[model samples]
Target chain A: MASIELKDIVKIYKDRKRGTELLSIDNVSFSVDSNEFLCLLGPSGCGKSTLLNMIAGFESATSGTVSVGGKPVLGPGADRGMVFQQATLMPWLPVWENIAFSLKLAGKGAEERRAAAQPFIDMVKLTGFENHYPAELSGGMAQRVGIARALLLNFSVILMDEPFAALDAQTKLEMQEELVAIWQRHQGTVVFVTHSVDEALVLGSQIAVMTHRPGRIRELIKLDLPRPRDSTSAEFNEYKRHILALIREESALARADAATV
Target chain B: MNWLASLREQRDRLWVPVLLIVAWEIFSRSGWLPPSLLPAPSTVCRTWADWVFSIDESSQANAGRWIHDALASSVRVFVGYAIAVVSGVLLGVAIGWWRWVEKTIEPTIQMLRPVPPVSWIPLAIIWFGIANKPAIFLVFLGAFFPVLMNAIHGVKTVDRNLIRAAAMMGGREAQILRYVVLPAALPSIFAGLRIAIGSAWMLTVTAEMVAVKSGLGYVLWDSYYFLRYDLVIAAMISIGLLGFLTDWLIKLLMSRILHWQHGQTVQGRNH
Candidate 1:
């Protein structure tokens, strides 16, 4: 059975002033098996994040259903851990406390929460800076804390919504490498949202390319690159070129539609 | 460069006060204004010493009464401010977090807010009588709105993504509110508390002047009846100093609690 499933999902947002509905996601369907790293890659406003949010249970689909581990998702719960676009760590909480927030909410006592959070903190390589507040950390360090927070939840499925989009280029590359290494070691299902074709190729086992607004899955391409895939390799280039062409085609079609309007 | 450095020192900040005192003394001795209306700063100092020390009964019924009166005013301010803080935060968080609560309570509260707390003095006197109760009631009235407004703003303005992140972690509603919402709203709540403290002091003194008779305000008014301008000035200074002290205390508490926000300080580090 698939670890996660999105069956004919649709999301419509009401434009109250205009009395018209904005269709965000249209009949999107996909499934992820256990230990699959699936990247949802598209241009901005392609509803990739919306799809991720539905899986995370942050947003409800207008129609259709999302299931995790064969159980339907009712609302946000411990079964699916999510890392947001921004590092939304509690500013008042220390690094360890933020990482252990899920356990804290579960009413685990301080010692247990602290104990459970340690491995994940080490997983993210943020061991010594456990007591530092979010404000005291740099942007890259904050995102690491965010990753640790998600990992400590011990959920079978992890959803990341542009988690490294705010970081500097060098930091983004480092985080991508770290993320892949973590995913490899942990072996869990992941649905990552991104606009970068290179990022999707670097990190994903399967890439789900999506079209512009009223978003639908354009294609789901399976990648056969070996572990520690080289970005400069011919195979990687070929995949990148294909995804780039798909995105350009969508953008040109969107522009043509806009010109007619 | 050395002169500029010296000019920027703390001692330089005191020059104006010293110069003002000297000018006041010269003018008082010059006798352009009646001493009964405008006493010298030295005379005010002498009366203040006697009010505190009671060495010669210079203040008559109010001699050695400084401690008692100041304590009474501080107690009223503390009690009222405490009540405001607790209730304001609870109600504010409720109104901010829940749409139903906001729709039901917020408009009424906002309508009542613009009506000055001072206008409620007659009602306070009639309901609580001329005692600590009236003074405290007035202080509560004055302090409550600021705390409420700020708390509401803080809670309402909390990053939506943070709540989403918390909810995504399997936190129940109560857990999300207590663990996520409360801490995120604290900085704004503290801002409200600071503003409320200032109002607390102001209302306490105002209430003492009319409704009660045992604070620095009472002493100032009573000294006016006896034509002791020096004592009146001394009482005014005492109120000002006490107000400054309480505000400083609140600021100290704020800094200790919000030490996590230290790195973003604009002026850099403190010595």
Candidate 2:
């Protein structure tokens, strides 16, 4: 059975002043098996993040159902954890406190919260920086805290909305490696949304390349590469070239549609 | 040498205020206006010292009574400001987090906020007659609005993602407010507290002037009636000193609570 399912999900945003309805997600259906790292790849404004939000239960699909672990997602719950693009951390809280915030909600004591947060801190390689405030940390460090905070939930699935998109290229490469290593160890499902072709090639178990504007899945390509994917490898470049051509064709068609409008 | 370098760097800060005092003393002694009319800074200091220390009772009725009067005024500000802080924060969180609370109560509060706290004097007098009660009630009114407004702004402006994060972590609605919303809104709440403290002092003094019989403002008004300009100047200096000290205390507390805000804000440089 699929660990998470999005069946015929449609999202329509109403623009009140314009008196118009804009459909964002167009009857998109997909599922992720247990422990699968499915990268939902698409262009900007293609409602990819909107799709992840639905699975995380931050948004409701207008016309379809989202279910995780055989239960319909009525709202956000601890069963699913999410790491946002911008490292949305509490500025007042130190790294350890931010990581253990959910524990605090669970009415855990200081000792317990500290204990619960330690393993995740080590998992994200932010061990020494536990007491540092978000403002004091580098961008990559803050995002590590974000990752640690999400992992501390100990959920079945984690939703990542381009969590590494803002990192410097070198830092991004390192974090991707660390993320894969963590996933290999802990073994949980992840739905990572990204626009970067290389990021999709490196991270995803299966790549769901999406069409633009009222997005639908164009292809679901299961990756069969070895661990620690070498971007310069011939097969890796072949997949990149193929995805690039598909994207080029998609963008051209989008432009043609815009010209008609 | 390290200490000396630090003092040298801040030398102008010391000298400028000293210079102003010296110039004022010289002008006051120049006999342009009578000593009663414009007492020298030294003369005011001497009278203030007599009032505080009762050195031969130079300030007469208020001799060694400065502490008592100051404490009385401070108590009113403390009680009233505490009440305002609790009510303002609670109502603010409610209004910011819940539409029903905002729809029901916020319009009334917004309307009342614009009506100056001083204008409530007549009703304050009638409702809570001549004593600490009226003064405190006025202070409450004065301190309430800034706290209320800031708390509302703080709650409303909390990052939506933080709430979303909290919700995803199995946090209930109340848990979101307690764990997520409160912490996120705190810097702004502290901003409100600072502004409210100033209002607390102002309203306390104003209340003393009109209704209360004891405190610095009463002493100032009382001395004015007797044409004791020296004592008046001493009282003004006392108020100014106390206000500065209170503000400094709040700043110290703010730095402690908002230590994470350092190197991120423009005001971070001063600390």
Candidate 3:
């Protein structure tokens, strides 16, 4: 059974400034079961982020439906936690305060917010830096704060849009390991979007490959490989090779379409 | 050593004033101009001390009356500026947030903004009479627009993603405005406030010269009529000193509230 569902979703953006229409998502449809880590793999112009936005209720589908826990989404709610490309932590808030921001909006007392934020702070491995402001933090540290802020919400589904795309490779690898460990403990559905094939193979329980501009799903592949998946493993390389070919074909097709225009 | 370092910093700040004073004093004593026409810094200092302390009542009418005049001007600036701060911020939030509010109110305000505050003297005098009321009205006129313009900019330019993040966190519209938009808009609001306070002091003095008669401006004008140029210079110094102090007080308050901005702002970098 699906924990999250998207049915024939279409998103058309009206570019009023350009006096044109942009078809960002073209009838894309998919779902994830509870506790499934689904990586949305796509090129830069693909609608993977748009699909995630619709599921997060930060955007509306032009057609069809998005349902979480069998209930249709009308708009953004506390039930869906989003980790954006940038940390997007309020500059005014320190790490602990940012992690507890949802509780603050709920009118929780300062002591309660402080107490509640502690576990997630530890989950993100940012225990001693609770008082540091966002500007004072490194990019990876700031992204950890962003993740903790979402984790404290305890949503059944977490949506991440290339959250660690800005991190250095070493930090990214460490963060990916920490994320999978946290997910194992939390046991929630996650829809992670990234253009990185290695990232998809490393983290995803299922990978959904999307085509470029006016995006539609190209393929959906499930991973049954064991935990702590090695990138150099034959199974991992096979999945990476298949995904790379799919994306390369999609990009080449897009370029051909552009040349014709 | 710490005191010496701080003193060196102070000397770097004070050099221009010291040089200007020395040049003025030398020129005055050179018999290059009539001493009566342009009083030396020493003479002005003496009159200022007399005005402040009533030492031998040398200032005659204004002797030891410095505090009263300073307080009077401060009261006018405070009241008028308070009114401007409230109305400007409120109206600005409305204008920036809602299209209806912007359409209905913004054009008239933009039109009125260009008219000089001093030009409102006749209307202010008629409406408020020749007292603090008229003076305060002018100060309000001067301070309101800058605060309003800045508040609008602050609200309009708030990052869209913050509002989205708040919404995702269960914030309703009012809560989003209160928790997210207001905090995001605060730095810009402080910028507007700092500018408006300077305008507040300017209008207060200009109003004192015409509509009101008990502040530093009144003393300056009165001393000029009596040919007491030393007293005139002393009153000028008083206005300058008070203006500087008020602005510095606002800066102190701004820095305290905006402490989070320390690492992110240009001013913070300077510090």
**Higher-DockQ candidate among 1 and 3?**
1
Error of 2 at A135 (Å): 0.9
Regions of candidate 1 where Cα sits further than 4 Å from its true position: B1-9, B265-271
Please tell me the interface RMSD, in Å, for model 1. Answer: 0.9
Candidate with maximal DockQ:
1
Sort by lDDT, best first.
2, 3, 1
lDDT per residue, candidate 1, B1-271, as tens digits? 9987776796778889989999999999898998878999988887888899887787777778889988988999999999988999999999999999999999999999998998999999999999999999889989999999998999999998889888988888898889989988888898898899999989998898899988888888888888999998998898889989988888888788877777766522561
Model 1 quality (TM-score): 0.95
Total clashing pairs in model 3: 0
Listed per prediction, chain B TM-scores read 0.94, 0.96, 0.96
Per-model C-alpha lDDT, please? 0.89, 0.91, 0.90
> What is the TM-score of candidate 3?
0.97
Q: Supply candidate 3's per-residue lDDT for B240.
A: 86
lDDT value, residue B154 of candidate 2: 93
Give the DockQ (2 decimals) of all models.
0.84, 0.83, 0.83
What residue pairs clash in candidate 1, if any at all?
Answer: none
C-alpha lDDT (0 to 100) for residue B207 of candidate 2: 91
